[model samples]
Target: MSAPRFGRIGEGPAAPPGGEAFSELLAGGGARVVRIASRGHADAEGAWYDQAEDEFVLLLAGAARLEFAEGTARALAPGDWAVIPARCRHRVAWTDPGRETLWLAVHLPPH
Candidate 1:
């Protein structure tokens, strides 16, 4: 058994954030939980990501926008979430540039 420790999910250094960073909180049994931070970040133009696993992502702070190859788009604010199915083509269109955008992501095996 593992002992529990309390910690803040949004606690980060005061330095100016650059690019996107991730921290894996847990990983086992074909599932992974991660915390991600983005500052003035977006996927490369015309680029898409197609992953073998499904991803459920929650926005913890700031805002983000995502566009899919199917021409659908979503805007997320703090406390909002999105699910990306395995093999779905998607890209980040935008993230709040004025502050850090924090995200909690859960990647799971394909159904």
Candidate 2:
């Protein structure tokens, strides 16, 4: 068999509401991996996630704020990383349109 192929996350067309554009980098009998980047505009509203998948996010550029259902919020910037537990309710609260924020999100199976 040939080696696996990986795709660029943001090179394709943009996605719609709740739509995520991702490129699968690795896949096998064990785990599947992909790269995802989301750019949010100023006053842009985000979708709420309530799934059972765990998410790991790395901020690549710009700045934004993330709000959780527990009434907690966090300001994020480049080089920052956050892990959202499974079934956690969260969304992006704010973003700068002039400066688009790039994020790499990795959705992994539950431990």
The residue pairs that clash in candidate 2, if any, are: none
For residues 31-53, what per-residue lDDT tens digits would candidate 1 score against the true structure? 99988888878899889999999
Best by lDDT: 1
lDDT, candidate 2, 1-111, per-residue tens: 888655654465443333334555665554456554444532234567675878788877667788887889899888898989989988878654554456777677666
Candidate 2's C-alpha runs over 4 A off are: 4-24, 27-34, 42-47
- Model 2 residue 4 lDDT score: 61
Query: What TM-score do all the candidates reach, one by one?
Result: 0.90, 0.68
lDDT of each: 0.87, 0.66
Evaluate residue 11 in candidate 2 and report its C-alpha lDDT on the 0 to 100 scale.
63
Model 2 TM-score, all chains together: 0.68
Determine the backbone clash count of candidate 1.
Answer: 0
